[model samples]
Target: MPAPKISVIVPAFNHEAYVVDALNSVLGQSLGDLELIVIDDASRDGTWDAIQSIRDPRLRALRHEHNRGAHATLNEGLGLASGDFLAILNSDDAFHPERLARMVAALDSDARLAFSGVDFIDSDSQPAPGHERALDYASACARCAGQPPASWLLTSNLAITTSNFVFPRSLFQRIGGFSELRYTHDWEWALRASTDTPPLWLPEPLVRYRVHPSNTLAEDDVWRHIHENAYIQTLALGGSLDGLDAEGACTALLHNTSLPPLATLCFGIAARRLADDTALRALTRPGPDGWFLRQLAQATGLNDGVFRSARQLADQQSALGAQQCLIDERWATIQQMSGIIAERDAALQAQAELIEERAQAMAHMSAEIAHRDEAITAQGRLLEERFAAMEEMGREIHARDQIVSEQSAVIARLMATPWNRLRRFVTKLRH
Candidate 1:
């Protein structure tokens, strides 16, 4: 087939969960004349297998035998492009179905533009939190009519990713591929490209930029992030600000004010003394100027840099105060919770003491009852002995009555007989 309209290069690392979706987003675009070149950067996960599962004729899957960084992988993918316009998508990020169509139309509107970009969505394809800052910058760019796109880019990396790129392949070959910076290579390239051909910003969220724990900028080393960013920004300042009149230079310089003191000084130094790259590089290194630079960098952030614009500095201070207030409120809430827990524990302790006292009382009552039961048993035995003695007395009285009756009958018999009366009289005398 002939060369495609666009060549989208996807550099996959460990995005097995997301690579297929990223590829599908490209292949299933409404603008269907594009070729999808996916390079798996020797991902340890199932990213390579996921790429292989895609069977579209427009998709070509490539793999790296060994691991390489994102910069090298992107450069290699760009080298194999066979289309008029070149684009890049990170393996973990996806595009809207209509993104390419809209971006292509934007690129066609201005021949002088290097590339076109849109706002981004978060991982779940929702509006990314704090994305308003990026939108505000875009809105500011729009409001600042006739401002050099290069100068505005110098302010911040509003495009934010190579995934946002949809530029001419020729420009990629001319300006360069990507830099070797670990963190901000996409930004470095954007700065490099904007200086020559300017970038076009589309205000719609056409791409899903995954903000996650494993993001590429997820570096715990504070120094490296600051150091690498300062390095690129300083170098960017050197030649990128040339040919600007007083207004343009001032615009660019003002843009650099929001940067740290090290980067701010670099912009000033590079503007005046950019002949030797070594001198600009030496400003950030540890040497005669190191202590002062460290102090300023460590001092109050941009607050120490009186060179910064007053409005932006005040804004930073205001933001810092707000953050401190929030921290105080959160601390107060935690203390309140702790107090409640302590009170609950005290109440529980009191209940336990009461239960122990009740148990002791019950034990004492049980002992008294046992003693009373023993005395009652002894009294019952005495009553039983008395009843037995009364029964024996009753038997003795009955026997005496029987004997008296028998004696009376014998006397009656004797009286009835001729000698009975004489016998009775004899018995009475004997008694």
Candidate 2:
């Protein structure tokens, strides 16, 4: 059988709810000459059943005898891809209808271009405002124009998601397909593919990444492992982590909910170790040292709230090594103070309890005290009722405040319309 122009490999596992969207996304692309290969990795759920329901001749669904991981499934799909070009689409991720059309054109125009990619949709499947720059070619080209070739996209949105990229089959083969490594495998693949050849960059969030409840990174344990694995891969690649600060930021974001204080500290140390590797000295020169410091601070639990604590400790310790040395000191102080405070406070609380008991004993003999106690109890009940009412009132007030704020913003916007139009006209006249 003749190979198609492009082969899109999709690895699906228990993504029944989203598989159809993924399949329809590929099948509905503007580009033709596309072959869709879906490898169902022994999904016990309705994932394979969903694939069976799709009747497109171009799509070939392969099933495994038993469940394998995403890496194994992806490699299996790779073996089945016969097109001159290769692309990967996760089961939960979809592409904009024109994604393939644009990337394929870029690859065809430049024989040396090993790959091309677009931006990914945020977790909500909506284009993220912060990363929207990757969705426009003009902006991407402009960003890359004056930068050194090696420094091209070193820090920012240079790499594209696996679902968003398309690469030549030869290049994919030469790189030996996807590595077994998890988390940063896509990033590693992107780096390797762009090693000798410059990959075309398409700025656009054509790939819609689904952030569902069952995401691997959602669990604390999984996220930590993924971040550590990514850092390990960065070290293994001989890639200078002068970008460690940026990576640390991404790490913090990825595992913010899951990572404990200690885990974050460890991740920061691991990141610093990566940055300090001798092999990466060339990549991280003098200019990025400040970034390293900032990253080190973040990793050491020095958030804005904790910065003062860090600063206070720095007065006693060296400002440079203060963060690391302060951890033990801080822990010791916290423990010692907590124990001492607990013991003293417990004794004082007991004394206060005895005094209260004596007061109650004396109060029991006085009829006036008994009447006052009843009045106080009634007041307490009234306070409890008032508190509940106030809570409800607070919620209503908050809702009303939000509505008022939104209305005010709308009014402010409308009020500026004439001024904005006048300014625009004046600007045009001046030009």
Candidate 3:
């Protein structure tokens, strides 16, 4: 039998609900010269049975006794693939009828191009919003003007999903194979595989990336993904990830909640380092960061509230730090004022002691003055008593002198008369 033009690898796990749809989408492709290889990685569900039910000459269903993982299963499929071109379609996703034809035509036109473009769809098989435009070949060529293909891919993955990738088998062999990682294996593989060969961009939505409840990318897993991406970036920077098989590296970077700025910077740098000119030009084009964030939010099917919560958390941290600084400053000021008050108290205590000593000296002087004033008052009272006794003696003397004068005058008058002289002699005998 002639070898098929393309070999489609479908890695099936616990996708019993969607595996049939995935297989039907590939079988219904307009391009019939293709081989389908579905690998069941020890699914606990009926996925193996569903894959077994399909009986087509091109269909090759393989199973693992013990679950290895998606990456291992993909490696197995790659080892068995015998087509000119290789493609991957996740069990949970489906492809459009013209996907293979369109991608094959694009690759055939340019032997240098490694892969083609991708499209997205919801779990209900409905067309994803904002991605309705078909791939514009001319515009894409013009945009990547003057830039190498490998450099363009390093900047941004034009092949948005692994399901959208349809590259030459030769390119896959040259770049080695997919790296074994739990999360971001596709991204890592793309980075390594497209380092030299640039991929083609098919703007049309060729693959329906179902956004369902069972999607592997959960909110809690974002940190792990970011860390894994950082590690991948490190490997790329050190040139160690070129063809290295990074098995279980995914387990090391887990349990993180948010993407740190450093990690984000590293991721950007890694992308630029790996980007071709086309990717760099597309990235340099004028656009808002919000638009990119919104695209991510839409692709992840997460609500805007999650981002708001992160913003609020960051604002709260900033406010808390500012408040802590103010508190520290106020505490220092209080300490300074307490020291000043202590010094003032010490000076006031010294002044109070001096004033007390002066008061004691003044009290001693007042006591001495009071004792001298008491002695002077006693002397003044004694002099007043003596002066009163002298006044009484003087009064008695004057009365006696006046009596003598009267007696003398009477005697003179008696001498003039004998009768007066006899009366005077009788008064003297009576005295």
Indicate which candidate wins on TM-score.
Answer: 1
Candidate 2 vs. true structure, TM-score: 0.51
TM-score of 1: 0.61
Per-prediction CA RMSD (Å): 9.2, 38.3, 19.7
lDDT tens digits, residues 243-332, model 3? 223431221112111223354454466466765523422322225643333355567897633433222446668889999999999989
Instruction: Kindly list the per-residue Cα lDDT of model 1 for residues 1-431, writing each as its tens digit.
Output: 69998899999999988888889999989999899999998899999999998898999889999988899999999999998888899997888899888888888845333334454556665666466544555655564445655565655666767888888887787887786667777877777677656678776768777766677766574444554556656655654564467677555545643355444554465547566644544443456644334456566665334534434567879999999999999999989999998999999999999999999999999899999999998888988898898899889999999999999999777669968677778999999
Candidate 2, which segments miss by more than 4 Å at Cα? 109-149, 152-160, 222-431
Candidate 1 runs further than 4 Å off: 109-119, 129-148, 239-258, 266-431
TM-score per prediction, in order, is 0.61, 0.51, 0.53
Better of 1 and 2 by lDDT: 1
lDDT value for candidate 3? 0.66
How many backbone clashes can be found in candidate 3?
A: 13
Give candidate 3 misplaced runs (Cα > 4 Å): 109-117, 130-156, 234-260, 264-431
Rank list by lDDT? 1, 3, 2
Which candidate should be chosen as best, given lDDT against the real structure? Answer: 1
